[model samples]
Target: MDKQGANMTTNTRIYLRASTDQQNASRAEASLLEFANLHKLNVVHTFIENESGASLERPELFKLIAASKQGDILLCESTDRLTRLSNEAWDTLKQSINEKGIRLVMLDLPTSHINLSNAGDDVTTAIMKAINSMIIDIMAAMARKDYMQRRERAAQGMAKARAEGKLTGRKVNTVTNDKVIKLLKAGTHSWSEIVDLCGVSRAQVAKLAKVVKAEA
Candidate 1:
């Protein structure tokens, strides 16, 4: 559903997101609402999450992906925020959207809006899809390269700190972990639920929550 959409009449599921731990999430919504208003469409839902776009899996993004229907329009503030990962993952995501018959909207990429409505169903549209897909492929590659460069710089900084013997690696905070115990003993929450609530991944949560349960 990576359509450059046009004249969308259906109520769109406007997804606004910021892929950082500290960055503000509200900024994604302001202009998207204006676009929806201008197009005379209703925004049925908005999901915002403070997570990295490089994360191959995200809770809110998955929920939105699964919830999308034939006529659903998945709106995002920008394409890079949807995925700034490897092209393979991006391809899978796009394939999933196409199979589900969803539409994608990007304020930063207006041509994507037209791809949503009338493009894929015709020969001319098919040609346009290829060209646009190529552009997206190029963009995704650049994003991956930039991600690698950033990681390299961060690694160099950490290495220097380690050499200076002044840097310590992150430790799991005890007080923060204690809340995971509270969630499990007081209510019937799933392990995954505990992970989300604790803002830790399931793998780490499994190791910790199990110990807390055994002691209790």
Candidate 2:
């Protein structure tokens, strides 16, 4: 609604994600809302989810992307929150965003922030987009590296705990397992839909499928 730097007005979609359920996904919502207001960008959608950045199965993020159009902004708190995907996954996501012509603006990457201005000059806009794309690529790589390092460290710690006889894997959630089994046995919904319905992963659904078949 409000005109920003380039005399062009566009809506912004705010994406907030946390790697685990324990983390508060919407913790940065207020700050992002303030940022949008200060920049004169009208925020049309706010999608928040607890999802692993290493995977691209984020339903909410995809919904936000699909719902957006050219000239619309995709705002995130940081690159890590947006993605810690492997190179291939990151490339896929980047391609989709570019193909949709959505502008990605991350707070941690100030280089992208300036590109959102929509300068009204084709040449300047093109230059900025190219620069911002490179910056995004580098940031995504760093995020993925950090993700891998953290995972490695955690794995090492678990191994040490196991060696000391102090490690025990998390208990399966029987309630969720039961729900997944029921959904799988019904054979009505797709695996992805069942995952969402039962709040379980596809791997869990596969495991339950075996149990259901064996019992049938």
Q: Which stretches of candidate 2 lie over 4 Å from their true place?
A: 1-9, 121-125, 168-216
Which ranges of candidate 1 are over 4 A from the true structure?
1-9, 164-216
Taking the tens digit of each residue's C-alpha lDDT, what string does model 2 give over 24-130? 99999999999888887878789999877887768999998898878799999999888888999999998888888788899778888975676675877778778
The TM-score of candidate 2 is 0.73
**Measured by C-alpha RMSD in angstroms, how accurate is candidate 2?**
7.9
Error at 143, model 1, angstroms: 2.1
TM-score of each: 0.67, 0.73
**CA lDDT scores, all candidates in order:** 0.70, 0.82
